[model samples]
Target: MPHLVILYTPNLEAQADMGRLCRSLADTMLAQRDDGGAQVFPTGGTRVLAFAAAHYAVADDSDDHAFVYLNLRMAAGRADAVKKRIGDALTACAKVHFEPLLAQRHVGITLQIDEAPGQVYDGKIGNLHALFAAAR
Candidate 1:
């Protein structure tokens, strides 16, 4: 089972990228929109229903190895395209560019996911939302 951690950009209006997903939970949530809880984006803009899409999780771990996985769902579907769009969004949010239009679309974001596990999960997985909610 993956331990999820939703993340957003500095603007909080745009969705998160792999870099943001790799951040700490506190850093991720701190990126949420100030006005309302949502995932912000640049080209994608602010998505109401789509706000919940930007997230990451601990995909697998053991005594010797572990990895954090960030997954972004996009209409584009192509991994390369998804990577590019997210990169552009991050750059815009980060002021990595001097171009006016590209830079202003940044927004804040929010994360909705599970807490760290106290014990390793080992049996058949159950209701994720319920499990995470209860843990929270």
Candidate 2:
């Protein structure tokens, strides 16, 4: 259960398309599997969400600069190499989404792969995966 959340400054809303970014991230995540295996992430559990920060201050506390932070969170228990590979793939996707704005202004893009506390993280998926495969 990976939740990809994108938080960006409000000023970038005019130039950024959150929906498209989410789609791009989802596609990239789906491409990577454990040891290059074929089992894909369940669509029902894969979440890509975005929130526009109403108030944010970048370096030097200037409003002229903007920032986009991505948090790729998943339940604990994975090899470090596997997690890093996934994180690296996602970072590239984030760069692709923010490059245009970055080229025009002082935009700082950061990405972090966080692991949810396994003890508290609970997840359950219905038959969405089966239905998706049937449609295909």
The CA lDDT of each predicted structure is 0.33, 0.82
Compute the lDDT for candidate 2: 0.82
Please provide, for model 1 over 1-136, each residue's C-alpha lDDT reduced to its tens digit, 9 standing for 90 to 100: 2223333322333323434333432233224332233332221121222123344332233222212222333223224443454444433333431234234442323222222335454454445446544664
Model 2 weakest lDDT span, ten residues long: 36-45
Please list the Cα RMSD from the true structure of every candidate, rounded to 1 decimal place. 16.0, 2.2
- lDDT tens readout by residue for model 2, 46-117: 888999987777789677888888998887777788888888899888888778777889988889888876
Every model's TM-score: 0.20, 0.85
TM-score, candidate 2, is 0.85
The local distance difference test score of model 1 is 0.33
